[model samples]
Target chain A: GDTSSAPASDAATSSVPPGHAGDHNSVKYYKGIVPAKDLKVWREEGTGNGKLAHYKPATKVDYYKIGTTPTPAQIAGWTIAVPPSGENLPAGSGTAAKGEAIYSTNCAMCHGGFGEGKNNYPQLVGGIGSLGTPSPEKTVGSYWPYATTVWDYINRAMPFYAPHTLKPDEVYSLTAYILNMNGITKSSWVADAKSVPLVKMPNRNSFNWKDPRPVTHNSACMKNCVSPSSIKITSNAATMNLTPRLTGPVDHMKNGK
Target chain B: GATMIAASARAASPAPTAPPADNSWSNSLGAPVDARPYGQPSKYESSVVRRYIPWLSPTRLADASFTPLQDQPGIITSNGLFFERYHSGVPTVDPKEFRLMVSGRVKKPLLLTLDQIMRYPSVSRIHFIECPANGATEWPAAQLNSLQLTHGMIGCAEWTGVLLKTILDEAGIHPDSRWVLPTGSDGAHMDRSLPMVKCLDDCILAWGQNGEALRPEQGYPLRLVVPGWQGNVNVKWLRQLQVGREPWITREETSEYSELLGDGKSLGFTWVMDAKSVITFPCPEKPLTQGPGFYEIRGLAWSGRGKVKYVDVSLDGGVNFQRAKLDNPILDKCMTRFTLPYWWDGKPALIQSRVTDDTGYVQPTIVQKHKFWGHDPVYENNSIQTWQILASGEVNNVQLS
Candidate 1:
């Protein structure tokens, strides 16, 4: 690094080596420089009574005190999320036998008649114990850890076209039917708030929640990283013929695909 | 005969200073302001538009349209050209009728209209939102030929909104609450359980994009902008926030977003995007048209953890690396532009760009990524991409062993 020794009293536009007078490398740029170690970050306690420390607000006045309190009816209408505990599930029950008719009409079009999946739509059942295989099929039976997810999803987004139209009983019935198709429950078993939570999914304890990241710490190996002869071209996308035609700048351009 | 000879003489040796005849636009008057209340790009720029493969999704309603990364320049993606990933069709949300309900494990549950949300002290920050499955199709092989198709599942923009912490503070979050389930009001009513720590951090309830009201396709009324996190958790058409003790284990978190492994186990809650960079210019669509001359290679690099510290350009397929100049205004968790001056020799070269974030994590190679995570886990494919430039200045997507 070149040291800047230009006189402070000189003209501001001094033509010096390594840096111009106005740029960062100039001597004047370091006139009021502060040491990096002295700078410290401090956060104020968040407005919420929670213990987490948050960034200090720019102003002292409370800006979020504008909204009005929601009424009991409003709260009940919007609070629809159901956790794995099933404590928030609505009062409803359905049998897998009764859910069979609902599945064929509503879900069978996309999720397949037996939850095997159709087209690009998600498969809901089967593929149990197939995660270790070469090609694992991650259906609801083999992947979902909780049965409440099935109920919540169906109640919230289902029928492929008409979502949030299913009654609580219909959602429960669909959940039961999907579970029965996966061989997790009997057709006669009743699926209520109580029995649904207790129904153990085959892959309930399958997930590793803690994110183990930075899995590959590849360094910048710049020199002769790999042998030229050993480097093989494993695949080429141009030969695949999967690229879609578009009206973009490359509409007329061809890469000899 | 004299006139014909003069015409032939002019055609054979035209004066270099003479202008061409096709200057119609220069001679004519441009359109007036009244012509378009809302401005649009030039007619010639119609080629620069978002596109999608029809077969990618089951239906058009629940699909994704990729951004034209090749055509885009700089960091900020235009509001109209930003990538769109909708679970169902875009719902027509009336701002006057929109109400965001904050309930579940809160002391005073509040119902806030769009106007009330805008009243809070607003802060705008630019950040990139990317789908977890950005390069999922190219894991085993480079399935998409164009850069837009391969790496267009991301868009960076300046989002304006109130801090979610401020709203949650007013609601008075319960001490036991660990998760906040954000539910969209779209046809799907898409819901996802976001960890409470993330909500309190940089998450904002964004209502504006690129200095304008949010587009209907981008959740006109309100949308949660979880910076650096996966796009799926940033629920658009945000209508409700339910603070809870446990994660709701929604469909997205389970069978959809979770990464399945070959050992009969899956990794859940993998939110943050790793360091990644890709060269936009000299890509498949924008190849080396100006053959064998001084060319400035341009690209975009970003990370979820922090700012990109530096980017390295490799002209010889990772054989050698040289630091590319990173453009200024490098903010945290935002796209950073990088450029490298090069003289192409018109030879076959494997061009690649590698990014190292502030955390000192170098972007992994495709082989390195597959070695640890295998060919599955169809998300978080931030591996270094290779564009094979042939002798004829044509580029192709290829995977190297």
Candidate 2:
């Protein structure tokens, strides 16, 4: 029944293939065919074979190997990303007093004066034990795992209307202000790249990189496993029907009648 | 002036007096602010706003916005009025720093800048960009009220860009390559893998919308415009393109946009949107008020696969149908307007429109569509929309029993 592959005739082979290529004949075919060259003679010579056959010994293949390396200043301008572990922290300092001024002028309208947040704009502080509860409202103090994430997020996109408008010192000050409000930093202390990364967040140990438990079953259910009864039953009839009976309410029954 | 007199004299003679009146917008305004560097929609047409149904999607900041389908008259929808859908929100990317990298199965890996993309031979096309879940209504319960529900999240714009086939050809795609993965530069870094055949067929790296540079929301520097396909595939803020033998199965394809069937199986890549049409005027919000004279019933019809061939309007619901006249220049994968003149008797009537595409696919009924897709994620829900006008001139969305 499956006899689709039949040998093409000489006429068909000389013409063109099917589908998109065949529609445009000029695109489908080559003018002439060349015979394969014998490789035995080439292999006998020391000039051909091994890596030397494809490439020369003195030739440089890579761009960096040809002495066309990028300058350090160029790399520093683009690759300024600092990690959460304080691995590539730069020398800078900012005080909580300066941070409060920056937050009030730039962020107060959307994020509230005290970073309490209005409407659905997100609360920046509080909600200390809300995680893993009925309705979790994750804030800087309660849910964020790393202080560096706070710094990175503020530096990258913040102030709502105009993102990346703040200076480096302003971003540092704002980070200190938000951290101080969350009770993570002292009111009088200033925050730097060195100090900010070491200040352990309250929920730093709350999260895990990977979940061990399976979110859903992987294998296909066949044979006995495919039965309706084989499906996981979470509750029974007795538990489903158990309700508090209204025995003492005669007035309610008379109204229904 | 001489042509106007000759046309009027010929019309008076009544020798098969020109093909019926076009009844389009008269005294059409020319392109104002022509000398300005950028262009925008007319000042008089500023009331159109992208709406949101509060009950369906609760959050204001996080939820989707609907295009004002009822308010828009012409075939084109300006770039600003286009609907927006975001996951982790729109990322503010600096155009100067933006770079598009093409890697993976290619002879030459290219890192092209925005300036280089603009230098390529660009082609402009007037096409419709629609979200797969455009008409997501709670059918069988209560039909939605406005045209915003019937046909929102869809817009037509003149997109100017380089054909994606040109870029792939330049890169010299390997023989083993089958899929092209496009990654976004948003905070979520959203990505999707599409068949290489679709890319080669017709895809664009658009930079201009409505004859001007793209808006920030519509991907200012560059965005993939996959015409007639779902909106998500037109990845905004495009950053990377990776050629691979197999699909990447990103979060968008696997978790979010995939549709779940009745049997608990999922349809992963339902790309092409079927034929769909919607009656814009005399809908629930507009109502029928002009008494008994000749009034024009106009609306838009389009297909994802090809150009719309015919649109039939039924006054008495689906009982009787009449062919509506289609406007000129019915472009492929673009919105086409259809109109019919009708005289009302100041009585109750149920109105509906059906679209037929060049691919010979007809718009299915609500019941028929429900039977096939079984609606969980509500993507590609294209069905015949009905508007019922009461004797008292009260209009509402209704379904025939």
Candidate 3:
């Protein structure tokens, strides 16, 4: 009898949330369950109170996961990253003889034909024990922790301006060549991710993790801090009450005092 | 014999001419044994170095490198001399093989080659590229000498590039696209997301720096030039641009650039650099001469949001301020040179400059800045720089309070 009664039909149709199971209203009941009309909106909104709604496709989805799994060859095309442990070793080998040729053409201009660095270009060989010294310059034999890192870096970025220009085989050969020059591997040895990681660096045990704790700082023993026996005051001027100045001798200062 | 004697007398007699200063070449001249196709800085300029105070960060190269702001006079820093800071080492990229792929949330996923990018309508702008951490030292000590803290990391160059809006349009961005992520082709593969608005506003894909091709270290073939933003966001050795509906919380955005606040909540993805200025001359390294008349106090002022509206110089530190004249061609989101003609009587003087941006954001004092941001210093320390000039014409870095 009232105007509200006339709009009840319209309210029933408009109650369902957009892009939800309730929008497809052909079925009388879903999986032996009938949801109340009022609960349609709640179910559609995913805010239903203990009531299960019909399954609906998600509005947003990751399309990358929807595709079929790529083949090893296809995956390898994009994933050129070689890990420190040599996990993704390709089915190829490269000898130092082949590597020498690649090095001369690609790397020798900047790194020198013999791996001696020129200017800003880094040296690739020697300095096996220079890690802990006052001047620590990193090279293949000296500072690199893993040989696989060299392979990875070369494969990803190298030759200064032209990065990722080398093939996987070429990268392997270059790695072999550099390692052979550094005396880590023999000239005949082929370098892959596996063989590269196994190559031991001379300074592999040189580095120690620095921890700053328990107060590394110390003050003079005569002051508020403990002085070790290593600290010796050689000057007797202080005990004699004669301050030894830089310009004048202690005798003149003592006589003046 | 009489004529020779007359000539000798003329030579021995001091001519009424100004004697030439020693014309001997400086020992710093001549190329090293190995000649470089590209010239490097003079060996004597070794004092002008990129330094990292270890206390800043233990291992991060993104820590800081002061630009030899004192050693340079003109606005431009040679491509090689431009300060570099990287989360990872500089990735050597080959230009010939480089390819830029644009995908995600687009009608046409385009893989544009470097040559294709060069074919686009190009525009050149003289903009200053500055790292967000350019003046990081000012955060700890605001009254520190200006050049070392401020000038070193900022370099002006004529960047030639295509508008990013053109590239986005060419890629056919979908209606759902809200953010664009530019990724570097480096070992770390550093990535950062930009709001669609900023990308469409004034982003550039630069290929040329200064007058020539971009240097290898400065992203030779191509780089994203996000003007007025942090330098890192202007991804070097750029390889990919992915348009998406949401921001990618990459390593650079999450682990590194995010500033940890006093409340422990980090201010994440702070892209825009605030208004900042620094006094270049009469800094710590370059002391003023003993006597002074009309000394031209010069420095740089820039803003990420917009043009530098005004720069104010204060001789008594931050007490009294005078309007410094801005050099011409003050383009939007670019460095503007500000100069103050002042009379330095060689007495002790504390000099500082405050820049006001078009957005009405004034460069705050270090104390004021600390109050708002707290002591959580990572980068983007854009505060007023101060220098103390001693009576003996020695300039030293000093704290205000």
- Name the candidate that leads on lDDT: 1
lDDT of 3 at A82: 38
> For model 2, what share of native contacts is present?
0.00
Misplaced by over 4 Å in model 3 are A1-257, B1-64, B142-146, B149-151
The superposed Cα distance between candidate 1 and the true structure at residue B115, in angstroms, equals: 0.6
Candidate 3: pairs in clash: A161-B93, A161-B94, A162-B94, A163-B93, A163-B94, B67-B152
Cα lDDT of candidate 2 equals 0.62
Better of 2 and 3 by lDDT: 2
Model 1: residues with Cα > 4 Å off, grouped in runs: A1-64, A248-257, B1-22
| 1 against 3, candidate with superior DockQ | 1
Candidate RMSDs in order: 16.2, 19.3, 19.0
How well does candidate 1 score on lDDT at residue B272? Answer: 90
With candidate 1 superimposed using the best TM-score fit, by how many Å does residue B257's alpha carbon deviate from the native?
Answer: 1.0
Per-residue CA lDDT of model 2 for A1-257, tens digit only, reads 11111122311433432211100112112111100121121112112223222322121223111112233343333222333333333456787799999888888777888889865566788876654453445576665545655665676456655554567788789888888888777777666755565566665443322112111121111123223333232222112221111112111122221
Q: What is the lDDT of every predicted structure here?
A: 0.78, 0.62, 0.61
Contacts from the true interface found in each model, as a fraction, amount to 0.64, 0.00, 0.01
Chain B TM-score, all predictions listed: 0.95, 0.87, 0.88
TM-score of the A chain in candidate 3: the value is 0.53
In CAPRI terms, where does candidate 3 land?
A: incorrect
Instruction: State residue B194's C-alpha deviation in candidate 2, in Å.
Output: 0.7
